[model samples]
Target: MKHIFAALCLLAAPAAAQNAPHVVTDIAPIHALVTQLMEGVGEPSQIIPTGSSPHSYAMRPSEARALRDADLVVWVGPSLTHWLEEPLDTLSGDAARLTLMDDDRAVKLPMREATELGEEHDHGHDGHDHEGEVDPHGWLAPSNAVLWASVISKTLADVDPANAEIYEVNSKRFAEEVGALEQEITAKLAPYHDASFIVLHDAFHYFEATFGVEADAFIVAGDGSTPGPAQIKALRDHLAEDPATCAFTAPQENDSLLRTVIEGQGTRIAVLDPMGDGTTPYATLIRQFADDMVACFSQE
Candidate 1:
């Protein structure tokens, strides 16, 4: 009887292990990246709920529970998701975890300027203002996405070695898609290398640098910090010089101030999704961004 009971417990252990779930942070871009890498092996729940900025976000009660139960947790790093740093460290135990910035295995952008609101920022050699504190928007670059997919796949396999084969398959498929997307973006934005525009925030540093596009002015001084009179005046001067026909921003940013600032300058607002929305299969989002850029410059 004792031997039988012990055998039953052993048999149930594997089943319990196999049923474990993954929990990733709520940053949409990271969520999308993880989703691609873990498509077949398993799905990852977001720790930071949608519609909140990751820069200053705090994990909710339910998010903590999810993290506590997670088999794997993936995030950008403390520099990117500053608010979730403490909670993430506390919740993640033996769970396989990967911070894209600190992994060193992945290619990342050079550190740039810091925002008053704690967003990452970077500047390209071309003298154009880039996005985020340390260019944490590495995922914006498709090549970086390839690196991310590889890393995520490997981590997922490490967590559940039995599903290693599945992770490899997903990684390969996703990498091919990203490669194609890179080609598409290169071809699409090739014409706009000289056509400069203005933006609400410096979120497109990586995007612009990757495609050789330039931004002339930023409506918001930093990440979520709004510009003041002097800053707006500076933008007005830039507008006068560059005469940007369009202004760009993430879908989540408020356009009203941008509209007001560029109002008399004759520039129109063009919303860009930094989060890589519905077309967020990595390749698809890049393609969509290409289309948006073309539309922004081509519009009469």
Candidate 2:
């Protein structure tokens, strides 16, 4: 009885001494991805809360606290979630920062003119230099997501060595789900034989390219800056002549601005999200995006 009790105490001592290391991420997609990776282990506490724009997000006190307290920090690198780059590096010195873009194993997609592949509906080019650009919206690519999952799995193992097996198991299962999602999206979007959509922002270019859809126009010119009245008017006039069935924009977009410029146009405004806001499982997010696009086209 004494020997058994001593062994039980030794096992219990590790559990008692170990802290449940906190994990932090910039946006919902990474947050959800990490959550899926740590599903059976523990959910990661997100730095940027839901409905927040990661590109221009101002770090808050509580968010800083979360970052400082986290034992692990996973982000999509400075280019994508640019705002978080400096602050995270500064605040969370001890935390393990895993970047999908810097993973070395991630699959990269080439950048091209948004109008090049989409339907030939000229919305008047602003001559915005995309000369040697790479897509910033890399998470939209499923293959990249798989690479991220692997990075996350390895990082989780680094943070919580004892639970390495659990992390590996979760990563494999999640990778399989992402693979299935890619296949399903390809199949569902195969129809519409000839369909393309317009956007208020160029964020969806990667998504469009991946799913074989096209973005015809954007209210914003380049680098997420809004176009002037003349440019918007030109786009409106172009759409009037060749009305797009749908005009999709980000969830965090200004509806008043969208309506003001796009009013009297026959196009329907559909809110599309590249990030998995208010959703779980990366696969579900992809499905939601696919379903929304199909629904938009099916409406007409």
Candidate 3:
């Protein structure tokens, strides 16, 4: 009788494991969105850890295993996290995957032209060049995020039909919250729409376009690589010529280079994190980003 009982327990373990859906997301912001949708249903796992750039991140063994085990995987696609493409194809080929960048509902924006420094500025010497590509930082735009929420809820509902109602409810709440955030951010940043600023990278173009904020140019390339000397010289000349009031740096990047470039120019240096680190519930991240922009650009 004891042997039979042990056998029964062993047989039921896989069934128990299968009871809950396993969803995995690539980045923090996307994970936050999935978390909001999966509230009261199941927890989603984040593949890309905090403080890591998806542009150049290599997956760990554990993360690869998570991908293979996941029932559903959500990611921004190859444009952002190019490292995940082959792994997803080889390991989790059968698993359901949602590439947000390729989704028709997502509001895709083309990468803006690099600021023309001057006739002497030669872009060919600079290896950093993405003159014509789509920006993958769609989450920074609240409208794109709202669309993502709808798609996520539907995907979750399709996979875990038992929790369809909960996902739907959560998605509706998310949309309403995002709408409110958009209105609030618009009002808060309206005063700084005409203000010129420089970002550490070009990731904020979506955010800028959505909120009417303008960035004169970015200090670094889209891939987070250091700009070549020519690029740096061009940026310095542009700054000296135009004189932006604010220069923003990312949390992961050292601001010394930025300070060196704009020293004695009275440009206030500030930190702007594209990834939502240390903030949960997703909405707080969006709010914090807006607040940070206002704080930096609104400074006299």
48-72: candidate 3 lDDT, tens digit per residue: 9988888888789998899889889
Top candidate, metric TM-score: 3
| Residue 149 in model 1: lDDT | 83
Error of 1 at 74 (Å): 0.6
Superposed Cα deviation of residue 233, candidate 2 (Å): 2.3
What is the clash tally of candidate 3?
0
Worst 10 residues of 1 by lDDT: 116-125
TM-score of each: 0.83, 0.85, 0.89
lDDT values for all models: 0.69, 0.74, 0.80
Q: Which window of ten consecutive residues has the lowest lDDT sum in model 2?
A: 116-125
Clashing pairs for predicted structure model 1, backbone only: 26-48, 119-133, 120-132, 120-133, 121-132, 121-133, 131-202
lDDT of 2 by residue, 1-300 (tens): 999999888877644134456888878888888888886677787877787766678878998999989898888777666778788878998888787777666655544453553333333345555656565678888888888898889988888887888889999998899898889999988886367567776777666767788766666633555555666666667666777778787777666666765688667888877776634778888889889888898885
Clashing pairs in 3: none
After superposition, the stretches of candidate 1 with alpha carbons farther than 4 Å from their true spots are 1-21, 105-107, 110-133, 277-279
